[model samples]
Target chain A: MPSGALLFQSVLLGILLGGLYALLASGLTLYFGIMRVVMIAHSAFLILAAYLGWWLHERAGLDPLLAMLGTVPLFFGAGVLLQRVLLTRLRPATLTMMSVLLTFAIALLIEGLLGYAFTGTQRRVQLGYGSASLEVFGARVAVVKLIAFGLAVVALGTLYVLMKRTRFGWALRATIQHRDAARLLGIDTDRVAGYGFGIGLATAAIGGTALSLDTTIYPSLHWHWIGPLMAIIVVGGLGSVPGAAIAAMVLGMAQSLLQIPMGTTWAQTVFYVALFATLAIRPQGFFGGRLAQRF
Target chain B: MPSGSKVLKLAAVALLAVAVLAFPSIAPNPYILSAGVLVVYYAVLATSWNFVGGFTGYISLGHGALAGLGAYSTGILVAKAGLPPFLALAAAGAFVGLLAVPIGLAALRVRGASFVIVSISLVLILLLVFQSWSSVTGGSRGLVVPRPFQLTRPEHHRIFYFLFAGLLALAVLAWWLIDRSRFGLGLKSIREDEDKAEALGTATYAYKLIVFVVSAVFTALAGGLYALWFGDLDPVFQFSILTGSYLVLMALLGGVRQLFGPVVGALIVGIALEFFKVEYGDTPLHLVATGLLLALVVLFMPDGVLPAIADLIKRFGRSDRTSIREVSAAELREQRLQNAGGTK
Candidate 1:
């Protein structure tokens, strides 16, 4: 119904949205990959980080993008402490069920604290170029979206290299693939899990900073994001970062394309629907057979 | 298993039922009656949730959506079709029950954490659908249900209080019947080991579907009743994940293995939550308190407070006779651990 230019523009916009989604989902996959914990509180952490960005921007006059430089490591340390203090004590036998309850409690705690501090009112980062758009091949792209996409690409690329090229990343991957075997090879898995969880939270900081740049956020807004991020990870295959990234892009494009045909609310159903369809058809996901399910 | 103890237990239950029935008559206060009504509503929701989540060992986070479906179904039928309120309520429950068939089939294929994800996604999808379908659902403006009975506010609250209390009793009765039946044993087997159950000739899928539908139907009934009693239907409150998780929290906190676990859970949580909201006003303190309660319960009383208390009571009393019949819940945990498979 729309022109070729319109469809192209929607696809581009969708890709940008997917990139943002991928940033959030990659952290979830990393946690699940290494810790075998669902980390349902992930969106809550992302929201908290976004609030941090908002606070930094308001008080220190730092850009949200720049705020991540300080907050990411801070969050990483928090995650490590969290793992060491609480999650590490859970029995491996009941981790799958217990973690859901534990993380749910953690999520409620974070949401309540954030609500207590910031109230439920929505807040957004007022950055330069927020309302400006650049024309590219007849499609107008918001500069904020472009920057978010660029940040997502850079973060994801760093994650890819860290997993593939570094010793710690290799240790992390080895632990994920076969924990007992890796332990036999002297991988100090407890330390890896602690750091792995920290890495996941660090990614949340990145995603949160990007989110503040583009959208209005409140303590409760995490509820709206959890479903879509989970869907992306599920569609990508539970622990595969590259698979999740591709799935996020595909979901983003589908949502954008659907928006052309229907309303935006209806378009948002794309990922959840994809999630159900994926579970029904291929529960192992697009990256099935690549890795054994760790739990 | 002693005859005298059985008779004593029956007497205790009978006395409790009589007291509950006489509560409205004795109190005669609108505030107390409303709180009673809220507690009964939660009892019905949490007990119904236990059918799937407890007996069947599927941690469903989408039961709230079932209730929402029921509320909207009743609302639409009464508001748009001009159906009678009571008839619409029954129809709404059945409608939601039928709706769960395909969804349960799709979601129950996956196990453990994936199932939780699917369950949450279903509720979110339903919430979005109800919110966006403004033409039928009235969207964010909300829908009002026509009350069938004409009575004063206090009298209306009293009547609904009785109605919800009766529903809770019925739900408990159904839970008891299911617990004693072959069909329930089939479900417990599925909860224990689906593959083993199937190998041993249990139709695991059918049993799961039946229990899931039954759970959804009762949840829908509570929703429809809530819509009627409250006279307002908003998708956000009706289909909220927070409400869904609260259902899990109550059921888990009360001891899902016990038939009346949800009732005790509902009573404690419902009353505490009400008082907290009243005391704390609009701040996030109530949520913080709820989180603390859930954490404390999960950490200290993993088998639920009822079982833990029963254990303490037995220890203090030093009775050789078993006070409560223990279900094979340990097997359920074993099944989940097996599903978790390799260490991570």
Candidate 2:
């Protein structure tokens, strides 16, 4: 076995990785909660936003973190437009099933466009402090990871408040809990769906920015992320925000810790294995109950 | 059925089969003949996927993995054990089909998005496994399968084209038998609603498992044939989600619910895709085009091209034969309003 210091350091690193993953999964859950879309394209959008961040950093000289201030609203608007234009027209009876194919097409469209524009080369957001590290408990931690973790915490915190405290958030939550009943009580479900989809996709802006800083990205990298994100959301109980957050961190940590014994390639199996085990044992997931299922 | 029309339909099918069989002889160049090989290859794989997906309403985005396994097994058998290429393919197909039992048990437990996730996760897991297990799979460096055929390149393509066409014919015959059988009804009931089907005495889980295995076998056979024919085994290409989705796309675009849907879809999509790749030289343009085509098909022809065209023909050519249920709710309401106005 490896030394205790490496394991301890990995635990911290895994938590940070989970936080980044949570930022992506939360958006997926929000879309599932409101519109029942699997949002397979969310992975593509995350990478697209990462490319945006990389572009902003390179062409405009903006910091990758600062680039989010511009990309979030842009993605939000794109999400709303997507709902209004294509998704809103789908029959409610087949929304869950049909959305898979629809979103899959959307994913291909985005991935292709990104590939066309950027090519398939891997990229990273270079930072002056990229190589800097701090020692703790005889283990070294990268500063970029700490900043990315901080960003996740802040963004997730704000998202929590927005989901719980504000009236708009309540409207969104009400729709998640009971969409038809909420509509019967005079909630404009269509509009809520639009905004909900928007807010969900907007989270990718944060995730993409953080991810670009943490690791290398390429146009086709979205394919690698899709399985893990799907696993996290499934384990978190489909539409539950808090469940997604917790699951992300837990799986993230499991993956990180397994790296010591499993190595990196084998360690990645954590998500797929977790996904299968969860579906077999607890398809409803942690917070699923009645809320997670659409029909 | 009218005797004359029935004879005509049979003749049409026979003519089409003959043409398909004769394609290798008539093709202008080896390039076109190889393209035909690719098209029929897709036909068999799509039909294989349709065995489960079309009947059960369960969309598996991981059939590519089944095909990949089939190809890899063929590679290993031929490369390591010195099995004849043809016999190895049959065994590989059977082996992967058997492998589907454990896979189906785990995957068929969930429905809807969960099923899609499970299907996709299976492929991802396999991709990782094959990539990491370099000793067995050759990992990224790729395993080389010896060319079993001693013929020239064009001759090899010709032989594989006939091989795949024969496979497609067998698959279609199996599908036809299944579609007309009691087992098909059980599968359809499960597709319509599994819980209700089980309550009504259908062995829903068994039907799903059986068909999933059957589907895996055919898909694997296609993959195995190609692996031996192509002489290379790359894990990434074999287990790709893109390949999986393409199978789903071809099946869906042609009309998953219909007997000829996958064949039609494979022809259109496979040919168009080949054309794009050839013309555009590999710039992701074909991907964009594919995405656009899939999006349009989903939006406008959700029932697939075959069904939609059939519906259109029914509406325009034989309106009196239109089923009441085929009428949209909005159209029914408008008709009711028009009748009320006429009575007034």
Candidate 3:
């Protein structure tokens, strides 16, 4: 009973949102896939990037997109250092509990510092193009979304090429598949892990920039992003980047559609129900082949 | 000698109970009394959480949702159904325990990190449900239930504090009983290695379910008490991850594996945070402190403050045994060999 134009608009909006979701989830899935680290700190890193973008935009009048060139490297280095110093020591331990506590602590620290500096008030990156829109099939779509989607596609495409074609990428994949075998073959497993973490964190920059374009940023955004990120990772099949992309789209579409039928508060519940149901049926997830390879 | 140990334990329990019973009267200040009540509440929640999270190694991130279920259920019974307070509390606990069964079945199929993911997802789902179902759950504004007993006098307030203290004491006793019971041993075995436990003919699933349901019951009871104390029930207060963090922090700071660890940890952390709040007003310093403390505790003292203190006590007690027999390297190697053989 929905209008065709409205339905088309919904689909387009969903795709745009999904692109951003995929950008956020890629880092999470990559870290999990390559290093077997859940990286609960991922959302915190994204928030950190968002804050950095906000700071640059406010102070230097720099575009949030331009700020990524600097923040990406900084977060990448931080991620690598974190893995080398803290996570490396906890290897072969259950790591799950410790990781949760560790990442939660980091998140708390970030949120606290942000609150102290910026207060709890929400801020948005006010780009000149933020309010610009394009009319399509009797619906107006924001130009920022289009730009964000374009950037996401470009970034993901480049990442795909790097992951599938590069020598380091092969090593990363090999290590994920069989650590013992990879080590036996003289691959620098530690280096791969470090770089994988770095790359994972760099993706956060892309996601944060995209996010700031659309929504309001606050100290609590880390908490808000974590639930959706976790959902996407689980539904996509942990450790599968392409699977994450597909799942994010599906979830984004589902969420957008649910918003039209059920109110905003209920939209989150629908996604979680779908997540639970999916977990019950396919705990390995939709693209679980990669997961099985590791297990 | 074993009888002496048992007597000592019983004496400790009696003394602790007496001290708790006398605390409200001893500390007449409303702030201190309220803090004491809060400590007991967290202690109960933390101990209940320990049964499944520590003993079974399930790490349920959604326990606050379970507690919320209990609070909301009790509130509805009292306000909508006109049930008596005590009866509503009992019903709430039972209902929440029952609700945990299906979630347990679905979640426990996965091991390790996957379990944590599922638990957290469950929490988010429940929070959304509570927020969205305005007619039933009273929406974001939430329903305010009347106090279980009117606090017309300071004596009445003292009585409620004592009541909560008693409930906390009961929860502690229940946890201690479970800790020493055969079921506890089964749980420990499963935690050490589930495949090994299953190989040894332990019904891992059944024991997990039992521990989870029992934990849920205790958590729900605490929730009921919370509603009674605050005279209000709201989704944000009940189902927040902040509540979940309270349990995690208490368990971690107290010593996850120890019986009285959560009790000590909850009291210490709760008091410390209270002091911070009083000192700093609404500054974010407390969050920073909490984060730093959490990191330090996990990194440096995984056994928690209680266990660390226990170790110190044991070391001091053993310091006089100068002629204690020490294992030779050969003997230790032989022991390792035997262990390996036994495992094989």
Lowest summed-lDDT stretch of 10 residues in model 3 chain A?
A286-295
TM-score of the first chain alone, every candidate: 0.96, 0.96, 0.95
Every candidate's lDDT = 0.85, 0.86, 0.80
- lDDT (10s digit) by residue, model 3, range B90-192: 9999999898887777667656566677667766777778887889879899888877776564655677677777777777788788878888888877776
TM-scores of all candidate predictions against the true structure: 0.93, 0.94, 0.93
Give the distance in Å from residue B236's predicted Cα in candidate 3 to where it truly belongs: 1.7
Q: Go through the candidates in order and give the clash count of each.
A: 0, 0, 0
Best by lDDT: 2
Per residue, candidate 2 scores C-alpha lDDT tens digits across A1-295 of 8888888999989998999889889989888888778888999999999999999988988899889999999999999998989997775545676788889889999999998998988888888888899998898999889888888899889989998899888888888888889888888888988998888888888888888786899988888898899999999988888899899999999999999988998999999888777766877887666865432
Candidate 1, residues B11-88, lDDT tens digits: the string is 978997897888888775788788889888999999999998887677777788888889889989999999999999
lDDT of 1 by residue, A149-178 (tens): 898889888988998999999999999888
- TM-score for candidate 3, residues paired by index: 0.93
Superposed by TM-score, candidate 3 places the C-alpha of residue A271 at a distance from the truth, in angstroms, of 1.9
Model 2, backbone clash pairs (residues 3+ apart or across chains), number: 0
Highest TM-score scorer: 2
Question: In model 1, which residue pairs have backbone atoms overlapping below 3 Å?
Answer: none
Per-residue lDDT tens digits for candidate 3, residues A1-295, read 6887877888899899888889889988877776566766788778878888999999999998999899888988998887778776652444666777777777788888988999989999988888999998798899988988987888899888888999988998898888889999999999888888888888888778777777898886686677888888877878888888999999988887777777677776655776677667877778767462321
Report the CA-based lDDT of candidate 3 relative to the real structure.
Answer: 0.80
